[model samples]
Target: MKKTDVDVVVLGTGNAALCAAIAAKEQGASVCMLERAPKSKRGGNSYFTDGAIRCAYGRFQDLRAVLPDLDEEQIQQISMPDYGEEAFMADLLRLTDGQTDQKLANQLVSRSFDTIQWMMKQGVQFTVNENQYYEKDGKRQFWGGLPLKTKNKGVGLVQALFQRAEALGIDIKYDAKTTALKQEDQLKKLIVEIAGEPVEITANAVIFACGGFEANANMRKTHLGNEWEKAVVRGTAFNTGEGLTLALKAGAVRYGQWDGCHAHTTDYHAPKTGDFNKPGDIYKKSSYPLGLIVNVKGERFVDEGADFRNYTYAKYGKETLKQPEQKAFQLFDAQVSPNLRKEYHLPEATCYKADSVEELAEKMDVCPESLANTIRAYNQAVQPGPYNPAIKDGKCTKGVCPPKSNWALTFEKAPFYAFPVTCGITFTFGGIHVSPESEILGDDKRPIAGLFAAGEMVGGLFYHNYPGGSGLMAGAVFGRLAGEQAATFCNRTKPLSSKS
Candidate 1:
């Protein structure tokens, strides 16, 4: 096998891996990044995202630090209330049912914006997320806790990071799949395959940012329980738990919820894995809050208007998965169809429209009588209140079973719309344990020397639920920490002699 040596090796080429490489290089360490995919498909799950980042900003000054290009007109156009660290931490703990690891949550919340600033210093660009808020009388009113995204979304994020890495002289090897790892005295050797040829790479420190096991079918069945065989993968198909398995084999302690993951309602026709050709979050059906979601039986199984779509979308996917055949449908009337996100109008969407409820049900292959009864009861129960899509307008159902707590508009308009949906597993929550500095922890509760982890594979940041846009934020925060700590360790350790 061809053998080479480096100071630090970062596995995976996603946002976290790229951030780790950039941070390590910034800290004066010679870094090499290995991507399982070819050059054309380098970035992992980060490439499939919408590139929104949930950050805690006290005011416009905080946003101005990272987004220095924001003009006065842009700043005055939007109303972004203060999303402070305390509020961020509360949301994390609340969404996870207080199951979030306090240490990790604190770190994630405190360092959220600083990491973005760090990325900005490395030539990353940002823009205000205009879609995050609704316009009222030509005034932008923000609702969700996030209002920032990479310019041009995830494609732009990966391209910018890759370009920055290249400018910094970092060695990024595409088509290099690190399959196995072995210890030879003080050196860690990674067994990688490039063009069907096995090679060995020895490094002083290693950082695993390869993501979670969401793409692995058997692992999904084992960890996330049954009926996951049909769950659509929302990111790169190359992520099959290789790095996670390697870490486990190396005696790293498995941490967090083994059966928990981040899932959301997606188009039933979406591919088994995310399609890079599409390149955006078009497959996601996030407008359920503006309407109602029903199972194949034409029954409302979940509280569609429980909260803002951003906060509740993650957990609803599990509910969708539990439905018969792992399928559900989101129904919207003409009254609320105008509020649907842009993705709803995409050509690839599987949407059915009819002038009446029964006709819509017949077209959707649902029992017409059951759907009519459900909608009739739902409309009657809706409380009379002002309808506002931007906030919790309190236009709720008064006497309905599985109540719609907010945005409960009556389905009185014709040309009702319905979209078939299924569960799309974005990332798994189970992962290896890590220290405050992002060092991978062994079973003995001690830091594994020369080992680090970040991204979705670093557990305890989430449990049964997650907030939207926080995935990318967590990756950057921990990726930066892992890179900094790994570089410092590489600087102190001596090169391992060839004792194997």
Candidate 2:
């Protein structure tokens, strides 16, 4: 077995792990990153995302700090409302039904802007999220609280982080899976398997940012219920909960909603696992808020317009999985087709277009009569009001069983469209508990020396549902926290020259 020593060892090469590595290096600690996948498959679930990040901002000047490239002309063309810390916190509490851990939520909300600035300084570029905005009265009015995304989405984020890590002289070992962890007198030992060979790495501190078990079928069935076994994985195949298992063995206490996960409505024909070649959220169909969704039986199962897509999309996948065939169809008319997101226009999407609802239903394999009746009933229930997608306008349904709370427009146009969708699990909400400083906590609620955690592996901040863009933001915020605390621990516990 090969042996090595470092001041800090970070598990996983995702956004959180890379941030932790960079923060530790900035703190003057010798850092090394261990990736479970090969170099070609690096950047865990973070690489599969759209790179949207939520943060608190008081004004346009606050955004200018992170997006320094934005000029006066570009800023004048966009409209972004101020999202303060209170609004961010309220959104989390409302989405989670007040079950989110207050301490962790507060830390994430308060430190979000600073973390975004830090990421910008580390070479990550930001751009205005054009998709979150709508052309109203000539100006692009951003609706959702989230208004920023990485320049080229997740690929850009991971590449920039990797480049920054390389520039900082951070050591990264791909194909190195840390399977076990042991506590020594003043150091932690990690047993890693590299290319089928065993290697031992002893470090003064360790940060676990390896992510959740969304990709593990057995774990999904056991924790998220049996239905999740058939759900598609929307992210990396390497997040199998090994980090959680190792932490549990080290006496860390489990926390958060083990049965809850961040799932979304993805194309029915999307691959079981995310496609590396077609990365970046291309398979997601989030335009349901602008239309209606029905099961194969041609009946509505959820309130399509309960809130903005940001708050409702994460949990709708579970509802889709509960359908008879674990599938659903999103229905739209020509009046709203132009308002659909870019994902709807992808060549690979499973879409059906017809001149009438009956023809559309026939193409989707749904009962034509049932679908037509359902659409007729929905159209009659829509009340006359000014329709607006930028805000929760009072446009709604009156007598519908499951009412459309906003953007209720009658589907009385020429061409009708339907999109086949299925559940795509993003990440698990269950994970180990950690302190505000990102120190891993034991079963007795005590910090474990020389051990810390970040990212999806550190839970209690999310519950039943999630706010879009907050997951990546939480990862960056906590990853930096974990790294700073881990580096400080190393400085206090052992000398730089000490080795096993």
Best model per lDDT: 2
| Poorest lDDT segment (10 consecutive residues) of candidate 1 | 491-500
Evaluate model 2: give its TM-score. 0.99
Model 2 steric clash pairs: none
RMSD values, in order shown: 1.8, 1.1
lDDT of each: 0.89, 0.91
Cα RMSD of predicted structure 1: 1.8
Model 1: colliding residue pairs: none
> How many times do residue backbones clash in model 1?
0
What does the lDDT come to for candidate 1? Answer: 0.89
| Ten residues in sequence with the least summed lDDT for candidate 2 | 491-500
Which candidate has the top score in TM-score?
Answer: 2
* Distance from true location, Cα of 368 in model 1, Å: 1.2
| Backbone Cα, N, C clashes tallied per candidate | 0, 0
